[model samples]
Target chain A: MRLAAIALFALAIISALGACSKPPASERFLQDPQALKRGKGLFIGTCGAYCHSTRKDNRDAPYLFDCEWRHGGSDTEIFNTISTGVSNTRMVGFAGKLPDGEDDIWKIVAFLRASREPCG
Target chain B: MEATVETAVDMGSELALPEIPTHWTNARPIGHSRGPVADADLRAGPSAGQWLLYGGNYENYRLSPLETLNPATAPTLQVAWAFPTGTSGQFEVSPVVYDGIMYASSSYNRLFALDARTGELYWRYDHALPGDLRLCCGPMNRGVGIHGDTVLMATLDAHLLALNRLSGEILWDAEIADYQAGFSATSAPFILKNMAIIGIAGGEYGVRGFFDAYDVATGKRLWRHYTVPAAGEPGVETWAGTSYENSGAPAWTSGAYDAESDTLFWTTGNPSPDWNGDDRAGDNLYSNSLLALDPQTGERKWHFQFTPHDVWDYDGNTQVFLVDIEHEGQPVKAIVQANRNGFFYILDRNTGAFLRATPYVEQLNWASIDATGRPVVNPSAVPLEEPEFRVCPGNMGGMNGAWSGALDPELGLAFIPAIESCQHLQKGISVYADGQPFLGGTPLITDAEEDTAYGHISAIDVATGEVRWRYRDHDPLGAGTLAAVGGIVISGTQDGHAIALNSATGELLWKFRVGGGVRSQPIAFELDGTAYVAIGAGNWTSMAAYQGGTTNIPEGGNLFVFKLPAGS
Candidate 1:
């Protein structure tokens, strides 16, 4: 009975975890092979290697690879941050300047998040 | 206090002379202004007792031919007077004297003509910038250019105005460039013939640099030469693809005019994004290079690249000196520069042939210059997108183009205010955002360990690559050098000390604490037979000051003029 109860508890926790876990926008592009490739190309063409350097020392702007953030790091937050830009910083508003507009910023953010992932 | 006028004929319009006055009302023989100084006339011939040339002469030599302030009596120097600029900011403007009146520009684009002896203001002109003005550096005007009846002042917003020297009224104003797009002017407008030649600043904001000449009398835009070549132009291949659009090769200081060669030898700044070159590939010709151009047509006669494809911020914007030197046992017209890349370079001024390159500082580690004058950059020092690298003679440590440098002909020595320091650089792709600076990488720290950072007045012999003498300081040298006729090298320390050294040996002779740091060049002139040394003691420019870690450099702009006590 105790073993059955333990099993039931484990099943209940697993169910709750499954219900709570919702894959982020960053995860979608980061995990999907086609999406990641397109995002990498878009990021490199538009924002990669610029002031938000992939390199550690040369970054005049904040690094985007990791989860650390000056504004926020959530998927919705990162998207809004990139599209709107932070005040008094070089992180310019790329809402319209990019060829793909806001979509490009999301793609670049996804590529940057991939750098923090295991495969990245 | 306020700027006071002891005596004057109102403004430039009410003045007695159409050009510079021949004499002061108090009757001190004004000898510097005898004739109209043309572009090619490097030695416009100082006949008046007033300070005339920007470098005391057109060659930017900073040498005073006036011998009254001899070293024997230099110790007895006493303050004649001090003219205080009303604001608190950089004072790098070297005063130009005509008759007994002195004309100078202060920080924030303020111009004043004062009594040379009494510190009384004659007239003042203010070129006010817009409130939202974006500038890479502080607004420091390097004095004015005067020719015929007009005084040319280059505004920080990149406008050239011809003002009536007698009344200080604007005769005409010509727009040089749109300042909001990172184009501005701080270097003094150079007057040659009837044209005012000027080079624009703001490489950090990614504007294509150029050499411009305006009509001195009417302020008409004459000829302009873009330093960064466009598509199909001579040096375009050096820049990869469309990167040339934002590639930088700015000129922050005035060039030395070779009257004989009819060439304007100007130096260019580093390319943008400063440290990262993935976008702008190849050697990036003309960035960190010196070009000898025709003043008449703005045509490039010859060019010499100092630090090609520079990942380091070694700007070639420093002044180049034209000197007649013995190269290979022949008297050759050589152009010598105490390069910002920590090397002293001598080039054949006529053909831009590399003559010699020698390290003036002890901290150079990036690359040794080759016989062809190209830098053999260390593979490790090339800032890539990965690991970082340490570099010596970090940007601000080598030499300052804004303060300028001087060459002593008699001593054959170039007094370069250099620093002993290093920095760390990490290179990556930095994009060019409009209305923002184009520093490709992060703005690397130019000064890392201040304890290891000492300054020097590195006196390099231009004729031969020799360290003739060096005067070390606890901090970097603040001001430019003056190769005085009294066999003295007058320079200043960042800690407010104006010092005179034996130019032959760098032996300290006289020193005085002016209470404010001196970042402008020391100037000497005579009244009757008496000699006086004058300099501005408010140095609020420098990266060190801007960083807020430097010493308490006294505020207030005061032009301190000193003369030896009567009969010593």
Candidate 2:
């Protein structure tokens, strides 16, 4: 009877997990191709165009198309950096400026991931 | 407490002549109690011991009648005072001195009203800029304009502000454009007939550039003259599809005003996607061109394009000078510009007829100007997707309009801060998004090419279209040139030298190392019969790429004022 109860409990846990929806759009930003395109537009227009250069060496700001991240490299870390900004640096928080808010920030993250190359 | 310096400086005893009056009144003080800058006062130019206009006068000559700081006294120039802005970026301000106060606008929209003679601050006003700001170049404000009791400034966030001339208090604020859509302004507002005239800067961000005149009293827009023609507009056919809407023809600098002709002469910059002109097919009307407009209505009276369908980003935004010159043995009202496209062009100010175009730089390999004022294109220099083409003047042009050049009407010569540089350019795909750089292709330079770049202060005789002489420098001469009645041309070098050359002969008479690169224009004024000259010394981001890097230069913002010793 104890073994039967354990199996039922395990089954119930699996059923609950299966019923849950997929992760939020922002969490799954890196995997979404459409989101990546939106991020490229945002990144190219804002960050890449002004402060950070998408390609080429510009001492004004870091080049965003390389794997050597200055602040943070992980998906969530970059999002946090973009939303909150690095202090004492020209990199300011774009959370308030971004029209789409969190979604746009996530899109920018996706774009950065797709374009980043292994640093020398 | 206001500190006053006692000195005796006067305009070289010229008033003793019978033609000139011994005692001249400043007429009515329009705005402020002590230092009012009236319309009549500004039109009288800087003759009254005050710098009332950005161009010294509406002619934009940048010439001062003060012979006190002539070539003789130039060598003995010693620092009388120095005012530190405490902010660092590009210190390109050319202060306006009126009554006893100096009004200077520095980087990040900081304006200071100080004792002109003592360099003691009376009041300070700093414009609040947004954290998420878009800027193509450094956040520099070239200078400020004064009229009545108000001083006018155009901010980097694309706003026209009127500050109380007496206390630096906010008088009125007018939004020029949406900064988020990539529009920003850096030029000093040109005060014309009670209107604060300003131009927008965002050629890199695909903005529809324009010059707007605002009612100084109400902060209301009087009229706006769009640089790029929109749909159904007269010049819309020059642009392919809807490209004209965002194609840049930015007027990012102040222009000269002619009270006689009642015409305002303003120049426009390059078209969008600076390096690739395939998308914008026809001659980009008014882009890289001079627009003679009616200041009252903001209507285009006449236009002369320097580089038609400019793919090289040769901006016609260089300083425009209105001079009455003897062209071909006849007195002609001429408009002259040491144009960025490697040429010094002179045209009839009234009719817009091209008189002459002369190449002012060594590496101007792109196009040669024909007799009819059109550029005879060189096919090899055109950008191609597969193979890159080497073009002269690069994207920075032979002369960048960021710094004003001086036109010595007395010498009939135009002193240009000339750059000798070139780069290989290839066409690349650029998709424009709102507030993003619309540079169709980026200018990539090799170390060898960059190392070969240098600059000079070239004096071009407007009459004969001949280069009289070039004061060459190891670094780019990025500072504006100032001419005085004493036959002296003053300019600064990127290597930190405030140099004064003989206006007629290219002779370097005096130079002072101010511990920082000098990128500002030097203005000469007199107080109590004592003559003083002022310039801002600091580094500029625009010259970084041309300089290879700015690590070697000392970086700080300070206004250095020099005057001859008590009895020099």
Candidate 3:
């Protein structure tokens, strides 16, 4: 019984250290290249094709590449906005719509951030 | 013929009228006593120097009988007058001319009554739109329909409004559908008998597409024909699960009517969740197809699917042209259409029998239609989630239904405004919301340069589906064509030029820089013994998206009227 408790303690310590070392969900997608590529595919296929545009003078929907953020600029805020869409507008929430669920959305956000220039 | 409104009230002496401009000296009197336009007049096509029907006639020929400005005299034509609508964005409205007045609708449902002879605006009516209204495309009102003294207009907020012809006052308004649910009307209402028929647009938003007929006397709906069938319906078996509820088959363009056969032929757009067809399997009926129905009862007579299980957003809503062609050595009534799927199709108008379909555009790699007119899609063209596949004609299509075609029944030629391009289609994921875009994939433009995308006006032989002649251009042709008598076919370009081509041969006759992209249909009419041609000049969202590099073409709405300068 004492030996089992020691093993449990060691496992808990290892898990804690791993959790502390891991990045946030918002930032984790940015670090991975495959995630960014997948995010780009999703971004180009979904957002760029239909509503939002890459051009600065997109008249139908909001332009994403620009610095002006209509909803929120933070990664979490963008994720939330994407997951639960803005009301009284054409932008609908895409929570369970994506194939990879939240991971796909995080990758999309990471792709968007990578494409965007740093805000002053 | 010019006259003044001399009104004497309680005063003994006659009141003086306003001084008329010198240009109005030779103009005809506004609101002459020619009687109200009857139902028979609408079916008679353009006559007596008047244009009452939206398609110029029920056959959607868009041809004018005026021969004053032929190919020989077209070069001498000068701008008679220009009326600026003062609105931004593309102006695609073809003004309805009758008696001596012209009725035109601009973007955002703004209608105007102008003196056909002079560029004087009698009145203008600006429609009140909702604040939170959702729209799939840009806010555009194609044109208006005229029945008696009431002018009919379909708005972007999903409402059909009746306005008084003289005063531009609102007569009555009827809700088409809920705008919040992504239902909107952009096509000009077609006046048939005593009913005004109009189609709804919202395939991008996954709304169940429908075409409706409203009583002209009262704003009550006569009947509604849903493009996508409901559960237990005859065509519902084509869809999987309950996907037919929001499966799009939007009849978003004007239809052609045959008085003899008593049939109304309308075309439908792409199915919803356009890219990935995994959710809804089987041949999605009615979507990307042509539907023939009873005009009065709205009962489906027959339907012909142009693209079965269409994953390529190829809308079959091009302008329907009713033509009588010699088929198999017999004169047969045929319905011809330059479809967005890069094919020029001919079908029996009496029966929904497919005669032939030939490729009208250069780049068509997705499928080849079979003997029964069903497309044999290439397996590689099927959209997948990860790897992108190349498909010709793209989403905008080889020929967009937005820009209409002109059919010259006399010459047996149909002038099609065609775009040649291919797109890399990649399947994406989509979710259905009340008013959200339901696109399940993205069609990425392959390349703007390297001649991958361009526009041309192809003169197609109606019977054989052969390309008689083609007038090529750098930019995609966005304007509708107007075929006038004297062997002249008039069309506009994206780079701000109104051009005239010989109908028999594709020879350029006259070209005028309109100072803006001419994206509207041209109408020809005669007033005071002079034939005049008019077109709307502007640019829109799709033109900007398709155009590459730098463009100097300005964007502004203006109605330009041209005529031969004082008896050539």
In the order shown, the candidates' DockQ scores are: 0.04, 0.15, 0.19
Write one digit per residue (lDDT tens) for candidate 3, span B230-345.
88889899998988987988878999898898999889999987887778897899998888999989998998989988888888898889999998898989999999999899
Candidate 3 chain B, which ten residues in sequence have the lowest lDDT sum? B20-29
Chain B: TM-scores of all predictions: 0.91, 0.92, 0.93
Arrange candidates by lDDT, descending: 3, 2, 1
At residue B318, give the lDDT of candidate 3: 88
Question: What range of 10 consecutive residues in model 2 chain B has the weakest lDDT sum?
Answer: B20-29
Over B93-135, each residue of candidate 1 has an lDDT whose tens digit, in order, gives: 8777776667888887888877777777666776756654545
lDDT of 1 at B385: 46
Q: List candidate 2 segments past 4 Å from native.
A: A1-58, A64-67, A73-120, B1-35, B447-449, B546-550
Decoy 3 TM-score against native: 0.88
Residue-wise C-alpha lDDT for candidate 1, range A15-84, written one tens digit per residue? 9998658655666667677666556555443343223544333223345766567787777688888777
Which rank order by DockQ, best down to worst?
3, 2, 1
Residue B174: error of model 3 in Å?
0.6
Candidate 2 residue pairs in clash (backbone atoms < 3 Å) = B8-B529, B8-B530, B9-B528, B9-B529, B9-B530, B10-B529, B31-B149, B273-B440
Error of 3 at B251 (Å): 1.2
The best candidate by DockQ is: 3
lDDT for model 2: 0.79
Q: Who is ahead in lDDT, 2 or 3?
A: 3
